[model samples]
Target chain A: MPGALHRVLFVDLARHRSWVEDRADLYSESLGGAGVAIELLREHCPERCDPLAPENPIVLAVGPLTSLYPLASKTVAMFKSPLTGNLGESHCGGRSAMALRLAGYGAMVIMDRSPTPVYLSVDAGGVRFRDARTLWGMSSSLTAGRVMLEREGGAGHRTVLRIGPAGENLVTYAGVTVETYRHFGRLGMGAVMGSKHLKGIVIAGNGDLPVADRGAYQRTYRDLYTRAVRSPAMRKYYELGTPENLGPLSAMGALPVRNLQATGYGTEPPLEGEALAREHLGRRLACSHCPTACIHLAALREPHPEAPYFYKTTFVSYDYEPLYALGTMLGVEQPEDALRLLDVVEHLGLDAMSAGVALAWATEAFERGLLDEKALGGLRPAWGDARVYATMLECIARRAGPLYTLLGEGVDAAAAEYGGDSYALAFGGLEMPGYHTGPGAHLTHLTGARHSHLDSAGYAFDQEDMKAGQSRSPKELARALLTEEARRQVLSSLVVCFFARGLYDADTCVACLSAVEKERNWDDLMALGEDILRRKHAFKAREGFEFDALRIPARTLEVPTPLGGLSENTLREAISEVERLLASGERFSHG
Target chain B: MGKRLRVVDVERCVDCLLCAFACARRFGGGGLAKSAIAVRSVGGMERGFVVVVCRACEDPPCLAVCPVGAIRKVEVGVRVDADRCIGCSMCVEACAIGAVQWDAVERKPVICVHCGLCAQYCPHSVLAHEEV
Candidate 1:
């Protein structure tokens, strides 16, 4: 291990005292990234502490492979979620991982809430806290990022992670946007930072990393880079980006439409990937050391409301989740309107998925007469009304009125207060992700700790089942998802993007790991992956999460999927079986 | 067998820094510490990046500033004699682009050897090894 690998940088916002401590034990066992971050959170976070309180600790970590390998670009941020009041973990990509790693530290732990708005700047040598009073409360969060870029020293080699007014206002679903387009998009991690009066974090560093075997490492790196750039899976991402999934998901009836009220929206011209590629896609972007370049920036050319002759073009990045959440889930028919809504959410620095679900719930509430102009403060909530949705999204971030405040808390909390729990598109208190495949998808969300479709990729498993015609018992499905998710812990710990799962199979990963540190073999790697998953689940369980506590939205079962209509009983049975399998100490073996 | 290495068109560089990685890997066994060239954002990434490497100046300030006579003008570019380097960091300060990278771990200065390994790895033809 490098001499600097053991040191943890500690930043105190109130006192502005920063220090580094050598904790090699944590790094040696946990292996950095989410693994070490979780350990730090356990030690620093007070039990049942208020997530927004000065006591809550935010830990960001980078793995050993960062900046040394391709696709190891994600930074793991772990803290108590202000949204769910449980263990919070969000992974982000941009220049964050490389910056943090190069900055001569393995991890950073921020604690002690600030008295006033501030941002932390870290370089290769030291850390400094700067007052952000002038930069705070900016409507366009990008303005703050631009200011930081100009004022701060590091330019291309640094990452600036900033929050918008949404986070400043403490919107529970607010997120921290980094490198302009990348985000710690889920679990209200931004709200935690805002609660501490933290406006942003900027990191820049340039240092040579020490390795065990330079010759083997270099050869392996070239091989991985070659494979990453040439893979077919990577080509799809580079070409159409994630929006490519939008068309196929919609066609397969997996796209969540109108808050999952309908699986398919016939009235709307399908907002598919192919359509966006033909019309809106302006440019492609990628994270540092990443060749996929899957980021799609869409150019929306529109006449400025004030200046009709002068048309202003806005470029917004679009993806599968955002497209589904803001377009189909909100009943938005016109692609332009969806893009506009996406632009508003992006500027606000709120999670588009949660914001769309919140808005969809509000629209449904209004349609059912559960909410009216009185509750909405004279603002009519309607589906497919992009203008109304845009205004409401901003209002929600700003916490304007009673309705906006409720909506800002997310769909689960909003529905609980407004009598629409039946249609609330949430799982494990977090809003549902884009997928609505079938019983498999719902079951995956219910069983997975994150309650996210990515938890177990149940949709992909559904596709596999379609091909295999093998109806394994619910236990079999749960075991498979759990094993796959556990294996992903290795990827996430290395902080690699999940999109590259095909490229970094277990064998390839072992080969790469051997280049860095030859001590560990394939089995050791697998064990570490399992241990990390268990640790994450333990944190969730400690926060009162139970497999049975998972709620399959009433709307999901009501809507027929492309696979078939998912029955409540089947989903419930699967959930119970999954719980049983999880409770039992059965080691899931992946062949 | 010595060859002069210079960047042909920097505008084509996507800021990937593959050349730097490749340079480091070519010498350091496989790690990034040994790479002689460095890439940094010029101002903001929106503006673009600047590739920092030895310009192979006729009167290289790095060589003149080395207190321990550690730097020498090689056939292709400047090379560092690690045995004599006292970790003085004079060469690093002498170079304007900060191309003379100081290895804090190894207590030595890393100067580009003009090997052109980086140019071979750069998929985009942003970096070129030219005999000037």
Candidate 2:
């Protein structure tokens, strides 16, 4: 069906030209989002291509379920990662998915570098190149976005994506900020865009989507909406947001603190979620088509320096990951200190997890005499020092000095250049997300496709084991993680938020896909899941990902976790089992 | 007496776009193309959102500008007779609040019928069906 979607928009930055190609098969067979994006990456990204080269293509895709169903609010971006030098896949939610879908395209492929700074304005009218020379070198991405918003013409649904000094300087962990709060946060998508001389993107459209079965569409949409809005399971997301995980994870002693030197801070660590909500909860936000406004903003009011009776209020969006990474992981106890560091990260357009981990590593290295005052340019790297951390972040974004330049390459590369590879706290070049549940968690990081905690959510597996009062064998744990990760491919393809995993199970997925696309069944989706997983693995393998060589961060093994002492051997065994299952090519059994 | 959709509190809006979808679904189609209500960020989302919908003027400025005599006042608001509408979009420009959403495909105004489907689906209760 060559409907409103399935038209892939290819934009060449060098020539300032854009063309459309109909790839109905890609959209239909793979569905959209991750499924289609992986295919685009494999087809477009050349082997051993420098990740920041103009030849590296950036593909952005929205699933068929997007704009039609609640919680199906993500847009998947695929490119070669500058940090990992591998396939980069990141999901961002906000106005991005809705704006892209309504703009009348299933996916967009951007190739080559522009001659000069430019931001692409996309709509039904097609891509228009706008000069962004002045907008370039802005202190903050927010400034660039604000300028773009004023210059935009389309009056319909809109989303603005821009990168800051970090991306412009080609910081490997720099992220492209989406409509403010949200982002394509992981893997270095921003650096690729930056290398292309692309400043930002302004997308606006409101094209109508034709419903294949009007009756089915209404029923499915309503069912999902009601489930999302009224479900008790979803309440925590909107009320306190993901920050609520802080107290519990700390209690479990699974929370990474002081750069994984220890797990969990004391019960009343100053940056607890409840205290933040009560004190500085500014506002709540929801991505388009998402009922749960899970994005929580902290209203930080700070007195302006050298200006008496004057203040500036900044709304810094925080989640469990950033709170842990920038807050407790750095031994940052004050709300002001954590929020201040986050505020700096947001403006610099750097990935919070990567930036925080970089600082944590620097502080630990300095303390252990691996780094010194001379190496830091006469600066002290201390835990919880937001002022110094903020300065370091600035230096990293600007690539100002030798040490700052190394830190910008990500901790794995940084540690490899300096000492401290054992405590680098990175898996597959991407910084570890805030989780230290057990061996399953470490195994997830080591063996998962992107090394993202969200890839397999092995933490949840560990939590489930703890609940069961017994730890599964390494092989059993590996199989469970593999199954969960494979199943997630279908959900990510549908582009549903992982938070709604329970509500949008196999049956819900089948109904939603059937209503929007062709008639779908559980078995078809299960088959698609395995295919998607295999395709992603194939891309990683072609990019030279070696399971045998994947490092299990020694720091994780040293720390006792919620599920007790986890060992490197257990992680190695689980990794081997995961490798076996991945190679078996057997159909994942459906429920 | 008739029901009217009112913004109970604009601040309560999460900008979920659920109300807009519900408005579009009222026409048995998908997308915001058919919705008579719009929610857009006020400057950036950090500030807040403005929900644009018909205030249902007592005199009805939209009714005065319909050159084809397509629009008429209902108990709560105005409704456009699609058959007679020339799609001149005079009514679209006439509504001060810009609530008369234009159906770019059909070339007509999708004025709210005050059925309150949008209000019913608003998770935040930003909108309410009020008695008039």
Q: In terms of TM-score, which candidate is strongest? A: 2
All candidates' TM-scores?
A: 0.91, 0.98
**Per-residue accuracy of model 2 over A1-591 as CA lDDT, tens digit each:** 322668899999999999899998898889888999999989988888899989999999988888888888999999999998886889999999999888888899999999999999998778999999999899999989989988995577899999999999999989999999999989998888899999999998787888788899999988888888889889889888988888888888888998998888657555778999999999999999888999999999999999999999999998888888888889887888899988888899999999999989999999999998987878898888888888998999999788999999999888988889889999988898889998878888887788899988988888888899898899888888888888889998988988888899888998988887788888888788888988888888898888888877788888899898877787888888888878889764433
Number of backbone collisions per candidate? 6, 0
Query: lDDT at A509 for candidate 1?
Result: 80
- Clash pairs, candidate 1, are A214-B29, A214-B30, A215-B29, A215-B30, A218-B30, B24-B35
Evaluated at residue A44, the lDDT of candidate 2 is 88
Lowest summed lDDT across 10 adjacent residues in model 1 chain A is found at: A261-270
Candidate 2, CAPRI quality class derived from DockQ: high
Model 1 misplacement above 4 A: A1-3, A154-156, A265-269, A308-311, B1-14, B29-113, B129-132
Kept native contacts, fraction for each prediction: 0.22, 0.78
TM-score of chain A of 1: 0.96
